[model samples]
Target: MADIEERRPRNKATTFLLVLAAAAFVVASALRLLGIDGTRHMVATTALVPYFTAAGVLLGAIALLARRWFVGTVTLLVALVLVAAVAPRAFPDARPIGVGQEVRVMAANLLVGKADAEVLVAAVRDHAVDVLALQELSPAMVVDLERAGLDEVLPHRVFLAEPGASGSGIASRYPLTARDLAGPSTLRQAGALVALPGADLEVVSVHPLPPVTPDGPEPWQRDMAGLPRPDLNGPYRVLAGDFNATLDHVGLRRLLNHGYVDAADQVGAGLDPTWPADAVWPPPVVIDHILVDDRCPVDTFQVVDIPGSDHRAIVSQFVVPAR
Candidate 1:
């Protein structure tokens, strides 16, 4: 009788904990599905939906092993929903091949102008990067990049070089004509038209302000909304840099809805994290991106490490279709 009573309490405790954990998962799943993160905390939490999906699967398995059929079913359904949202990103989608021109684009946040210039220039030369978009650019960093032979390989430039993080620049192997993309934001976003062989491709170095405070998300959301939409009638457009947002963020998904496709997502590298590269806390997240028009077929995508930078470099090759 004594042993039976002890086991009963222990079983109840386990059930209670299981229910609590299941509730958390349910909430997370709901937030992900709704895509209405209005505050900084909620926005940060939504970024971890991929991790929650993994937890949901494990929770479901545990519940089933303990014969808690109701909890097991619920958790499994939540896991399915999360999986359905993120799994396609793991598999490459069928993209049409373009026989016109091959263009390699690379974007890197310089960690407030502190990333290694020599390494970045080497990456450009090694990867044959035709257009390079740089964020967190500074005047000294521009000088450093040139000293490291950036100008030799990518001579054409459009710079909004500042002393601090509010700076952006684009260097291209081909000529760059300044394209106006000014906006009411904190970051110095830049844009230019790349004179390619057959077309003048428009490339924007994007860096939206991050949602850090309670009132910060509003401005961040505004910056996201203000991003230019891809025009099919115009030249091919590629937006690259640290967006301060992720695929799970409704803002980014909304931008993608406007005829833009994330290069990493199209190539099965969507889940790859790009921020907080050298940090131990906050793990890592995918905030840097190379967003191209839907017509441009991505051939290759890579996340590269640059010493002293908090964000990884995203280098991608795209085949721009004949216009």
Candidate 2:
């Protein structure tokens, strides 16, 4: 009888934990369904839905082990629902092997002029990257890149090398024609048309303002909303850069709703984190992206390390779809 009484307290503690886990899952799902991540605090928590879902699953398993069948079953069901919602993005359709015209593309953030020019140039040359998109392109970095033989390798370019994080640029092996698709002054976005042998590609380097504070969320959301949609009827389209928003962000998710497919997500690499490369606490998230139109098939996607930058570069090989 004494042993049974002692077990009651432990069981109650386990049940309490399980209930909290279930509540977390419910709140996350409700926020996601309501599209309420516009605030800084909400956005941060919303971005961690996957982690919270995983926690729910863990708590459920513990409940099961403790023989609390009702709590275990309920929590597991909630976690499974969240998992199902994420599954499509977590494991998208795989690209067919040896199918279309291959084009290697890369996007890197310059950390507001801190990235090494020589290192950036080396990455372009070493990867034999066909198209390169860059954000935070300072005027001095442009000169340094040119001196480091970037022009000799890329040959074609369209750049707006402003002073800070608002700068953006694109360099290509093929001929390029600049386009006026960049939205307002705060967006710092740039676009270009690349002439390939069989098909032309429309590339954009995008950098939306980060939502770090309460006052900044609305502007960041506005900048993301102002990004131009891909002209599906025209040439193949590719948008790549440090977007300052992830798939978890409603703004970016709404942009993807316009029929664009993320290269990393298509290849099951979507969940890999890309920001704050050197951080140990608070974890990392994928704010950088290489989004391709549905017409383009992503062959492979990978993240490349760059020194002195907070973001890891995204490198992807896309198979140009048949016209």
Highest lDDT against the true fold, candidate = 1
Candidate 2, residue 303: the lDDT equals: 87
lDDT of 1 by residue, 1-323 (tens): 99999899889999999999999899878877998876788888888888888999999999999989999999999899889988888888888867778999999999889999999999999999999999999999998998999989999999999988899999999999998764566788899999999887999999988887656588888888888888878888898999888898998999899889999999999999998897757958889999998988988899999997999999999998777
**Model 1: CA > 4 A from native:** none
Q: For this target, which candidate reaches the highest TM-score against the unseen true structure? A: 1
Q: Estimate each model's TM-score.
A: 0.97, 0.90
Alpha-carbon lDDT, every model: 0.90, 0.83
Q: For model 2, what is the error of residue 146's alpha carbon versus the real structure, in angstroms, after optimal superposition?
A: 1.8
lDDT tens readout by residue for model 2, 1-323: 99999998987887787777767667776676577875687777777777777887887788788788887888788778878766666675867553566899999999887888888889888888999999999998899889989999999999988997879999999999998665684757889999888888888898887787647578788878877777867887888998877777788888789868888889888888888888865778888999887767787888888888888998998888666
